[model samples]
Target: MSQKPRRQKHPKPPKNWQPPPDDKGTILVRRELDEYGLNIYEFRVLAHVARRESKAEGCYASQAKMAEVCGISQRTVLQALKTLCQAGILRKEKNEKGRTNIYRLNEGSKWKHPSELEKIRKAEESQEDELLNLI
Candidate 1:
């Protein structure tokens, strides 16, 4: 028997991305994550963890389930988890059953744009200048 073609998870966006005003926030998130270093898969993991169900005070997902939802291989999921953890974007623990690893997100951690770093540096410089004048 022949196997069906694999489904493509990240299809190109429509020619026109102008959505109704109500979907503006969702659009913004896609743009922001893209601006950052996250690819579609990475963003999905982050977005999922950011949701109420996933990021509650203490919530986690098994490596198996995460792999299924993210449509990636189990090994790929582990690598992604490592990247997220090193970036201070997610926290993880081994499941008690030893069957899977549990994943969580760090609430305060966020990826900032390169431009934002420049703005922060300029602000700090100005603040230092003002402090020097006062003294």
Candidate 2:
């Protein structure tokens, strides 16, 4: 007796299928995020994560998936995620059962503008210079 082929849990899209137009399906990244001093990889990864967010599940894409979609290396994705999290622009929660992380974009208020970061950098540099002078 011949066995039947198994069915896919999720069917693949047709060869000719195309994504919806920008107006129909859009990812909204606030303009202020641009002033947050994010590098190119960080920006791209953040945008991709935002694109994957949903009202029900939030973003749970693996680093490999993020790298694949963002056209970046997994290590680069990891670094970008770390920077974003440190900057308070994104929050990451561990999924115990899934063994993956869920990402959420924090409110704009939590992010620091580039000018603030520059000020902090200058302050630290001046402190370093003072320490060196004493030494």
Candidate 3:
């Protein structure tokens, strides 16, 4: 007997399908998270935390959870987090009950808002003006 063609195990997301919209704070955090000199693991961990951040509550993620999501050991996650906090790229605080840590992204001089891209344009304009003045 001929067998029917097997269906694909998992369907892909539609082209228009997107991850849940990030909160305003997350959008701002994403723009600044890369500025910190983070190794690959740290970057991944911070990105996961930023993705989970809510505008109302900020970022709250556990080391174990980050380890599971990144497929790394909890120790590695902890080290990365420590580095981030030391570098001032992230701020970590114990929760009210001291159960888990809450994280906050440090806003940088650059990429503070959606209009930050405009700052680049302004810089370009000023440079061009300087060149024109020199001419």
Candidate 4:
């Protein structure tokens, strides 16, 4: 019997191949966030903010710019920001000297997981239904 050769998991890059010039910087997102119930727009906005963060300035990108970079509407970006803030996954503060808001990622421990958020929503819905039945 002949044994077949094993395929490489990641093939090597081509010789003399250069990376793209307009490549944006990378963002490090924790694996735990996968269970945080974040929608696509929320995740995209978070990633864009993370990429633009700096030690001195933090992330102060405007909603319009974030929407442009994340390819979503400004209203969607605003809604995502609100949800992230409510979930304690992000902190948004007004810039004292500027109109744009400063955004920072909160500690992972502060984040409410998807399951917990879902439970809360279900409980609220049940309460509303019970109230309607009483009426």
- Name the best candidate (by TM-score): 2
Rank by lDDT, highest first: 2, 4, 3, 1
Q: Residues 46-121, candidate 3, lDDT per residue (tens digit)?
A: 7877778776676777788777777777877886776566555678877886689888877654223434434544
lDDT of 1 by residue, 1-135 (tens): 999998764434557887667754654454545665655566666665566234334346666666666667666666556656655566766667665556676554464443554454456568768989999
TM values, all candidates: 0.50, 0.66, 0.54, 0.65
lDDT of 4 by residue, 1-135 (tens): 999996523324458888766655433456688657777777878887777877677799999888776767787788778777777778888889899999888878888766666565456568768989999
Clashes of each: 0, 0, 0, 0
Which residue runs does candidate 2 get wrong by more than 4 Å? 1-29, 115-135
Q: Which of the predicted structures, 3 or 4, would earn the higher TM-score when compared with the native?
A: 4
Candidate 3 stretches with Cα past 4 Å from truth are 1-36, 109-135
Off by over 4 Å in 1: 1-34, 52-57, 94-100, 109-135
lDDT of 2: 0.76
- As a TM-score, model 4 comes out at 0.65
Q: lDDT score, residue 23, model 3?
A: 75
Given candidate 1, what's the lDDT at residue 94?
65
